[model samples]
Each structure stands twice: as C-alpha cells, then as structure tokens.
Target: MLIDHFPVLGLRVRTPRLELRYPAPDELAALADLAVEGIHDPDTMPFGNPWTELPPDQLARRVVQRHWKTLSELRPDSWALNLAVFLDGVPVGVQEVEADDFAIQRQVHSESWLGLRHQGQGIGTEMRAAMLHLAFAGLGADEAVSVGYVHNHASLAVSRKLGYAENGIGRGVSRGKLALEQRFRLSREAWQEHRSVEATIEGLEPCLSLLGAGEE
Candidate 1:
C-alpha cells in the first residue's frame, strides 16, 4: 500500500550477505544509535567533514537530521539516497549514493561507514560493491567516484578492490586542519573488471523515470 504512494521504498538491493534500501523510521533510529556507538578510531579523523567529532547526542541527531533532509530535498536530477545497510538482517551501517545533474553527467558519488563492530570484516567491501551494482548495473552510470582521507587505508583498499583507479589528491579542512583526501575514479570499464560479489536489484523499473532512466 505505501509502495504505491512512495515507490522508492519498493526499491531493494541485495548481496549475498546484505540488504540495502531506504530506512524506515525505526531503522533510521537504529542506524543513528549504531553511529553513536562507534564508526572509527577517536584519535583519527577518517572523514573530511569531521561530522563524528560532536558529542554522542549531537552526532546522533545529525545522522537523523541528514537522512530526513536528503529525503525532503530529493529531485530527479540531483538527489541523495541514504540506505540503511543490514547484514544477515541486523543493522550494521549506512550506504549513501548521490549525484548532481545525474541525467546529464551520468556520474555518481558514494560514501559509507560501518559500525565499529562491523568493521575489519569484509562487510564494508560487500556493502560498497552492492551500491556499485545499483549505480553501474541497475542505473547505467558511466562513472562512480569516491574520496577518502589519505590515511584511511581501509576505504582506499575497498575502492581499489572494486577496480577504482587513483584519480589524485584533494586537500580539504578536517577538524581545523588540512586533510589529504585520496580521490578514486571508477569508470564503467573498470567496474566491469571487478565482479566478485553477486548482487540482485529489485523494484527499480517503476522508479526509473524519476531517476532519469527513462520510462519502461
């Protein structure tokens, strides 16, 4: 019944070990609490923006606010889809894919973070690969780009494993200090080279037009 009114909720992306889709209200709260629990080492700043520096309550509030903002501001040409990632039916992290003028550029950008407990496992790679499947295979994207802090080796490794080439370095301010960000580029050809994870996407056809993928 709800899918009839909001078709985006109908979309689903599934990997061998995970399921990713728009988070319901309860799931959004779960994702927020997971963020508060931990995402990375407190001594190091892995993200360029430093959103995690806030106190737990503020950080949790930011996470919740961001999801709602993205949903409210969505446009066909420019939008962000923040999906709650569930591994074996347990909430583990958030996977975000977004674009600016997607119809014209056919480009997408991605960012994600798994809870501290879920890290050091292959879950991060699988979650990213699953989103890449939605971007490249399901939506027909030409390129997908990601940026990670230079010292964020784990993120870099995941991008490399997914066949992304090193684009260059991007400097930015993080926690009032200059941060080295590594840019990664994944062309369709490069993406085709890596397919270790098997993924399936469902309920995409009805929403294709809204995503500028043309009518079925």
Candidate 2:
C-alpha cells in the first residue's frame, strides 16, 4: 500500500473538531480552491513573504506546487509536515509543523491558515493545539516556536490562547514596508499546562525515522 511505502502519508493528528493530515490529491485540490477563495484581507499581509498577495490563479497554483516541493524534498534532518486542515471532514486550510535537526534540537515550528470564511470559529486555535499535541506528546519535542506579525491579531491570539510566551522581536520587510514580528515559544511544560484541546496522533511511529525521531 502507498501508506506502507510512505508512512508520512498516513500520519494524522485529530482533535474533537479538526483533523490534520497529509492531503490526498483530491483534498489538495480542495485546498487550492479554498486558497483562491481567500485567506486574509487585501490591505494587510500576515506573512513575511506576502504569498497571499499573488493573483488568484497564481496563489492556487502555488498552494499545490509548494506541497509537492515539501513532499519531494523531505529529509530526516529537515522536514515539513504540511497537513491539510479539515473540519468536520471538509478541507478548510493547512496546518504545518516543521523542524530542523529535530532529533538533536527536539524542537518544531508551526504555522497555519484557515479560509477567510472559516475564521473566527476558534478552528485556528483548535487545529494548532492538535499539532502541538503531535509535537510534544507523539514526537517528544522540547519546544515549539511560532512568529506572527504584530498586526496579525488572530494569529497572535491563537498563540496566546495556547500558552506561548513572547520569545523575542524580529523585524522584516513585508509588502515593501517594515514588518514587526512577535516571536513566540511554547515549551513542552508550558504546553502541558495550557493545553485545553484533546488530540491524538495516528500512524506516527513508522515515520519516526523520516522525522529524525526514531529510537537511537
């Protein structure tokens, strides 16, 4: 089976209201359509790269193309699990957890987005909590980090709700202007204290080696 050969394809992190998993081709198509529909407001750029500013067609194409690149380029030392975000079995967005030298550093970084239509229902916090569970509980991570532009209130709110402490400040250019970023960090201890959502991980053991997390 494909899952046996590519165990990452079988990874899943599920919460009561959300599921995070590798996107099947059909699900990936749905995500692309969702991206074309929209994510953030036009006047503000949440990401440093300003990917959401691309034309509709280009944005859709980039969604699919980026997923392909992440899949093909995965390695034990550096990898990204760009799981599609599904709510009630419907594709809504993406929840990504990535790491560099994970086994040595035991840390992961996460980012996510929900369709504009899907925002404001707490799905963002729930989906992220699910990933946090996968990182700290299933994968034995030490710390998890996230960064949000100071103006991106929704992302910052989610981080605050999840018990992330301010790590530092970072400055960058976004949309050709200065962007102030609030870097946040959540240690495993903090996660355990702040975690309110229940989540479970399935099919992670087989992909441990690929994530540089296998028993040594």
**Best candidate (score: lDDT):** 2
Candidate 2 lDDT tens digits, 1-216: 977777899998999888899888889989999998989998888887778878988999999998988888788999998899998899999998999999899999987889999998989999999999999999899999999999999999999999999999999788899999999999989999999999988999999999998953
**Cα lDDT tens digits for candidate 1, 5-120:** 55778889999889999888888888899999999999888887789888999999999999888877777788888888998888899999998888888899998989999998
Count of clashing residue pairs in every prediction: 0, 0
Candidate 1 Cα misplacement greater than 4 A, ranges: none
- Deviation in Å, model 1, residue 16 alpha carbon: 0.5
Clashing pairs in 2: none
